[model samples]
Target: MAYFLSSHITSTLWKLKPLALKTTCVGSVLAVNQRKYSSKDDAGSEYLHRSIVPTMHYQKSLPRLPVPKLEDTIRRYLAAQRPLLDDENYSNTVKLAHDFQNGIGKQLHEELVAQDKMNKHTSYISAPWFDMYLSARESVVLNFNPFMSFNPDPKPEYNDQLIRATNIVCSAVRFMKTLRAGLLEPEVFHLNPAKSNTDSFKKFIRWVPSSVSWFGAYMVNAYPLDMSQYFRLFNSTRIPKPKTDELCTHQKGNHLLVMKRGNMYVFDVVDRDGNLVKPTEILSHLKYILADPTPAPVCPVGVLTSENRDVWAGLREKLLEAGNREAVQIVDSALFCLCLDEEEMRDHIHISHNMLHGDGCNRWYDKSFSLILSKDGQAAINFEHSWGDGVAVLRFQNEVFKDTTERPLVGPTTPPAPIDSASAVQRLEFKLSPDLEHGIAKAKENFQAAVSKLTIHAMEFKRGGKEQLKKKKLSPDAIAQLAFQMGFLRQYGKTVATYESCSTAAFKHGRTETIRPATTYTQRCAQAFVQQLGQHSVEQLQGMLDACSKYHGQLTKEAAMGQGFDRHLFAMRYLSNSKGMEMPNLYQDPAYTAINHNILSTSTLTSPAVSLGGFAPVVPDGFGVGYGVHDDWIGCNVSSYPTRNVHEFLQCVQKSLEDIFTVIDGKPIKSS
Candidate 1:
């Protein structure tokens, strides 16, 4: 989920409010002791911290997300608009914004604040955010769900499909057990892990009550994030409805759902006592499914999930009416879906395509998530967006990757246990009427048409990266964002609206806030390098880079703190629509529509466990850019529809990065 609000009128019917704030008063003695700890972690200790305290210990005392004042939101909103609009259009947008803040927006803001007081459990954006996703009429395949690919194992032999799948399944069950037992580590950002991540600190914090544990952790500058979405990680599915969808989770399911060649199979991974079955048993069952000689179904029912929400809802009703209720229940109540693809990935482009949407027949797009592995052992996760954000998913991935790689339960030489494989694994069979079969056929056609229009490409910049930029005292993220601006300018000779998603998970039940990266500073700096190269001195250009970095840093902090303007403005508009009030002139302005369109949708997620991540363009003529800035290189995996030139765009981005590196290295700017 990029935090872009859908412009569909039906999606604006929900009311939203911020979670109530919680204040803790710690004794002076503790405060003095906390001051002795450093906020910087020792080298390589950042990922060493483990959860000694219970997982939900910080839930009660975590502070609520704040509501920015109407004036501040207006100011920030206009500042973001200024870079994307011309002088005449900006003047018009300014008047509309002024009118809104002083008029109906004031009342809307008041009502939003009052509602925040009434609803104390979730952040202001939660309800509307959910509404934005569930209410979307498009299929979740490309328009909504995203994929993150796991890096190939260090040991080449471990990449064998059966070996990797067995290990992943076992590690996944262990993760579930650890989480259910409350022994899993809480997600935290340790500014200085050397102090807060020590055994003594963990022992002390373990004794603190759950209600006040957040305060204790905060004293040492350790920030624990919201883990409310973790519970939905297993045994969950998204059920389609006429106008919206609901997230369904069953806590008692013991069987695992496996799909291959459009056929469904189920086998028990958890015993009756809720303990994970032996890894040997899991391996045997998986081997049975893989060795089955059944061919692909003539009418693969799974593709129906890739249909439009309303269409899928209607087809689902037909399935139930056709006596497929038990089969549907088994799918919905299974622990999780594990997809075993028959084809091997050919390259990075093939990996992106295969992992993202895949041959629609072999995928269950409505599952809370799916762990997919190809025949060649390349693995990735494709997940439903409405149930949760990447925070929960990434944490789960990190743990699973660590467990499977570091302490794998199954090895290359491990043999499947001698057992009755046929009786152990049950193939799920659904009765289908002719109408349902026709629906499946149409769904396959639609899925093919939709995914066929997409073009994906990948690029890597080895000239410079995070380390090089850090040495120059520039934000690596800022430099990356600036590269996008310059790249767009160099390709299309214009600057457009861009979006970067920032997680607001520091607060209770928080979602995301939009980091509008196309700012006036970035625009000016991009123009200097892309258009006026050789006209400016290297020192002056370096100063511009510093300015862009500093401003971007400020934007990132503001968004993380829930002080960004986009969500606030979105909430107010949602409130207005729910109350049946006429749309505010500010929203009616074309400038508002253009900004929300977000031509360049970008998000960054860097993890040791992840090789790449990607999503499709949100609009027909846009780019879905997933990028990472590693120590020595920056990589981008981008997708586009036919309206855009993805290949040329990446070339421009690469050139822009090279030019920026040259300027940083005190070399003359290359003439365009």
Candidate 2:
């Protein structure tokens, strides 16, 4: 595979000799045509919202994601490979870049520009990028799906499962109302260094988007009974014939799916009058489900979701044939999923087991939001990342928790209605054949096997948080990213190509840009700590720290400007697929594969009030590291396959952060 750089590559090849304020890497210098940002005094705040927003109020004025000039993208692509490649390999990649820029790259850029013009009325990358995401060959299980868990609320009343589930569903409805009302402020991602450029930044900034697709659909994992074992069973008239087209769960609908103890229930969050139900009403409905004592025959249908995408798609079609079309409609129409688990889970490991693939019976993993409340009242959300990134979901979760914690929980003073009268909630029964029953049994075994291989470590670093970084005049995200880099270095004695998501959400419908975090400055900082140890001066370390932070900031701004190398690369590849063209040499180069094979996939979700969820490693050899930066403490969750020792790596991250404090404070060293 061809290696490509992301952004901010300078042409100058100056290496660090003695520590300096700014250290330039061996790459093309990033030309700064400093665009001034517009301050409120100059452009006025009203100019920010000048355009008429159509559906989503803040979306109308935002600019479309730009296609970078071929020369710049090619230059960046080459520069990114310099650090990872040997001299010979680097030279080969450079030549390949020349071949691409002059030959195939020119043609592809022209086609993309034409395509961009066609999508000028809409986002150029939106549809193409989404389709491409669906075409990936890798398993979506751990890599693509990300989850977050909220710690127990301060209120003791929430310990009652029914009360917690009700409040959570209501909180989600409140968020949904906010989304529909367009009252939630659109996120601002660009850090415009100058005030004059602010207006331009506002005009072109990427922002957290409001997408209809993310909210109302269930991600259906469909699997059929094993063909070899039940060839004769297919001839039975009782079985409904399966079709492949019905397998996908991406379509959106209007109902909610609630799963508990292998039983599935369908209910409407809205009344016939189109008004959302009250929290009291929702609580009453959940209590009804809790009162039902009959155990549901385990439907292993949910486990098929954890399988490969193509395989699940096939199985979903078959599962639908077993009298589940109506059930599917209810699932598709629902706002989201509510998982009512009777089991208690206090630690991250146990929470992960339930959230990731709970019993393979009570979860329908297809929905964008799957809210789970345990018997002990611990809550978490399992989000399918294909619809949006962590930031979008984090925003929703933050608001829900904020509303829950701030408001008083008051039950109705009047007597409640009997459970039998409420037709709002109904249990969904699936008529599964004996053959399908066998499939369910097999799926459960497979799901258990998958969960057994996963290793999770949930640790809280009480040492320091965002406030500590503020005191050091450092970006909290930057310091955490560096801590991850240092941890990786300590564990493997080398740095892997790292990915830290940078929001491009300043633009219309913007999601994220890959901010490659393993910079030359970070490399040197890690080297200084490992090789020099106590010998490195504070000035030298400070210089490195400043350089790393500045570079990261630059990357963020570039990503916001749609200059991210990854998306452009991804778009170009998708174009080739669209045109039925062969894969370019730039993509086929070894360097490309090396970088894309990410060994360290990390993201930071900060919500001062809640403990965010964690996810599976993106790759078999990698680890999924998510950290929450609060006022006084940092909550970290590290997960990997059974083969990798994430616990040790997390310990290293803690040590690295402490060591950083020691260096910044000029304190005496204590060897751990």
What tens-digit string does per-residue lDDT give for candidate 2 at 469-537?
778776666777788889888888887777665544434545456767777778888878765777777
Model 1: lDDT to the true structure: 0.82
TM-score per candidate: 0.93, 0.80
| Lowest summed lDDT window (length 10), candidate 1 | 22-31
List per-prediction Cα lDDT, in the order shown: 0.82, 0.59
**How does candidate 1 fare on TM-score?**
0.93
The candidate 2 region of ten consecutive residues with least summed lDDT is: 18-27
Clashes of 2: 49
lDDT by residue (243-277, candidate 1, tens digit) is 98888999899989999999999999998877778
